[model samples]
Target: MTIGGHLEELYGLPAFTFPGPGETPRELPEPDAVAWRITADSYDAEEQWTEAFARFCSAVDTTRVRALAVGAWEDAYDRGPGDIIEALVTARDRLPGLRSLFLGDMHSEECEISWINQTDVTPLLSAYPALEEFGVRGGQGLRFPALRHDALRTLIVETGGLPVEVVRGIGASELPALENLDLWLGTSWYGADSEAADLEPVLSGARLPRLRYLALRNSEIQDEIAAAVASAPVVARLEVLDLSMGTLGDDGAAALLGGQPLTHLRKLDLHHNYLSEPLLRRLRETLGSAGVELDLDRDDADWDEDDDGTVHRYVAVGE
Candidate 1:
């Protein structure tokens, strides 16, 4: 079976409604309704997983499928690593029109899929020639392929146990056309001397020329690197900036937020870090005075309310 047939079998034609006099509509396809979500686990018990995935890919009409999410369920751990990779490769190869590819919750104890040392997963990225947005979450030691693709605009890599050097090296070499970069350094902490020093070279380099949105979450970035990032000429074009969950205290935050030359920045995310109210107030004042938008992740309960109120509330911040 082809991908189109598989989609037909999986989902039916979407229901539609028209306006009627004195009739109230329960739902409407709002502007934000453009998002689509797909979840696929290992295939059925009687069928081979790779064959099923191939059939699923063949059935889908990639020309119309704009956003795709490939996720492994808890049962994915029971399957062989090779089979998992094959299934993923099939989807990526077939989905030519995919703009976003979200790889979520890939569990591998041996680092076969997620670790930088594995290197087997490099070929999987080749299928996404047109992919503009890519996100990987809850993996271990996430790495990138050396091959660079010009179509990719946004890349988000969040993983555990990944060396900061490996992350920086990958960022420097790959993703030349990248505009948005969200990197979460899990194992590298500020107190660790080795990891802190490893990231210095990449931070100083002029790698990301087109990068407009940057998020460094849960990383061990020092004040010097933060200052470098703020001073980078490329940062002047940035529209969104996120440095949350780092060891940056009030001083580091002040230095970064104070020296931002980018007046085009529409959103800034500084959540769950070492920012106090005074510092937050200063950030807000800076952004407000410059007519730049801000999205400060606050501990106050009211913050969440504002978060849920609108999509793209602050253009440069959030997921």
Candidate 2:
């Protein structure tokens, strides 16, 4: 399944889209209570995001705006968000109350997840130091560097293929207050280039002390990820551990059941995987009794085309 729609709500605030060129924005009870969205009408629209952003800033009280969603820019499939990022950074003082920001919220219709060209978004983190939640989509031309930040509590990066440098950057970065982290490590066929070793720092929890939830979804190497995560020091502290939308099989599930006693975890999500029925039954029988909320749904129905011990699996989202 593809990303079908825009976010209904973000940071506990309803998303309010600022109208495109020649359109009118609706009246809001409080600008601060809504997540203001600034996006162009289309990918190749003559009216670019710069104009839309300028209009939003002029029409709304920026200081009171607490959340922002920057959707598809003009030619987002080909262009990086350098100019848009600069604009947001330049206007940082005007958005002092902005606590949540989502960059590149385009669905596959406008730009496929593997096609949106992104740039180094590290500047946003440094500029919006007070931001509590940050979400980014797409991975093509994406770049993230390791840095220190104290106030960020949630970080989400969704992509059809997440590169290694970005993953390693996050693993090495210092995020003391980060409680939730989600990384969609899509298939390598589209440029996902990280191994389980790349996740070592994050699994150690050395840099992210307050991390309580960790989701490593959509990977060609889901079993390796599961094996690494099974005994990782960070798993002991996480309330929710998600290894969904990937190629998980009985091998990975076995590692999870063997390495650590997951009774302490509140939830374990393994949806959209390639696990067999026996393992699924075993999981339900075992975790069900332990009160661990397990999600083993949508285990692909056609997972066994070969009996030669060679497995064929696919990730949920990839270009």
Model 2 vs truth, CA RMSD: 1.7
Candidate 1 C-alpha lDDT tens digits along 49-138: 344445434444545666544444333434333555566666564555557665543334312232312123445557667777776654
Range of the 10 consecutive residues with the lowest summed lDDT in candidate 2: 299-308
Write down the worst ten-residue block by lDDT for model 1: 1-10
- Would you list the clashing residue pairs of candidate 1? 2-58, 2-59, 3-58, 3-59, 3-60, 4-59, 4-60
**True-vs-predicted CA distance for residue 236, candidate 2, Å:** 0.7
TM-scores across all candidates? 0.65, 0.96
Candidate topping TM-score:
2
lDDT value for model 1: 0.51
lDDT agreement of model 2 with the native:
0.89
